[model samples]
Target: AQSVTQLDSQVPVFEEAPVELRCNYSSSVSVYLFWYVQYPNQGLQLLLKYLSGSTLVKGINGFEAEFNKSQTSFHLRKPSVHISDTAEYFCAVSDQYGGATNKLIFGTGTLLAVQP
Candidate 1:
């Protein structure tokens, strides 16, 4: 089993400023980590993921995250922000080999409110 926890419920940042959204997880077995973003009233989009090699994974909108296995964390970071980046971000964990019935366990979600 696996579960995720977002350290912050919301993050406020000024335009062009850097932001980091922290995520932590617990699992008895190996799991895959994922980050997703959701615009207002929109479906979730895959921001990034860590399924195999490369602890540092980059996604769209210049978003990136480092998967730390020792600490069981996969924190999302963006060097610059824009008003359009203001959206809800989610961290998820799923069993690495629990295919067919593998379900994603998501965090409460963090709202990134980018200010002008």
Candidate 2:
């Protein structure tokens, strides 16, 4: 079975600060990568994904990540952050055959605490 591990449980920063959330995975086959964000009392939104192209991938809200094959990692980062960016960020992975429903296997969770 494949699994995902998020290195941090919470990250606190001032408004307009920068942030990075580390992610790692273990899988025997090729996989798809994703970063999803969840606001308070809401469902998750797709932040970004790495299907099968370049290692560096950009997504909505000025966020980006790099897929490292040798290290089996996908870390999310943002140059600057906003208070609105405060939310739970999840790193996920799915098998290459992943379809709509089989799209993700998420990390435990990481709460981005953006202080104003």
Candidate 3:
């Protein structure tokens, strides 16, 4: 079985400052990872994904993540943040075996509280 753990449940930072949301996963087989962000009253938006190839993946709003296989981590980072960046971030994983039914196992979620 595959599972994801988000070390921090909440991250508070000032506007225009850098921030990182940690994520780690455990799986027995090959897996795909993803990051998603959700604003208040909005659906989950795809931030970035790691299907294969490059270990470093970039996403929208200047957010990027490095996939570390040895450490089994994919931490999300941004050089600076905005008040609008305040939202709920999620890390998810899915193995390749389920085919059409490859459902994502998501972390508990981390709330980014961007302060002025």
Q: State the local distance difference test value for candidate 1.
A: 0.94
lDDT of each: 0.94, 0.94, 0.97
Winner on lDDT (2 vs 3):
3
Models 1 onward score TM values of 0.96, 0.94, 0.97
The lDDT leader among the candidates is: 3
Candidate 1: residue 96 lDDT (0-100): 80
Query: How many steric clashes does model 2 contain?
Result: 0
Candidate 2 per-residue lDDT, tens place, 1-116, comes to 67999989999998888889999999999999999999999999999999988999999999999999999999999999998999999999999866568857889999999999
| RMSD per model, one decimal | 0.8, 1.4, 0.7
Error of 1 at 1 (Å): 2.1
Model 3 clash pairs are none
Error of 1 at 42 (Å): 0.7
C-alpha lDDT (0 to 100) for residue 101 of candidate 2? 80
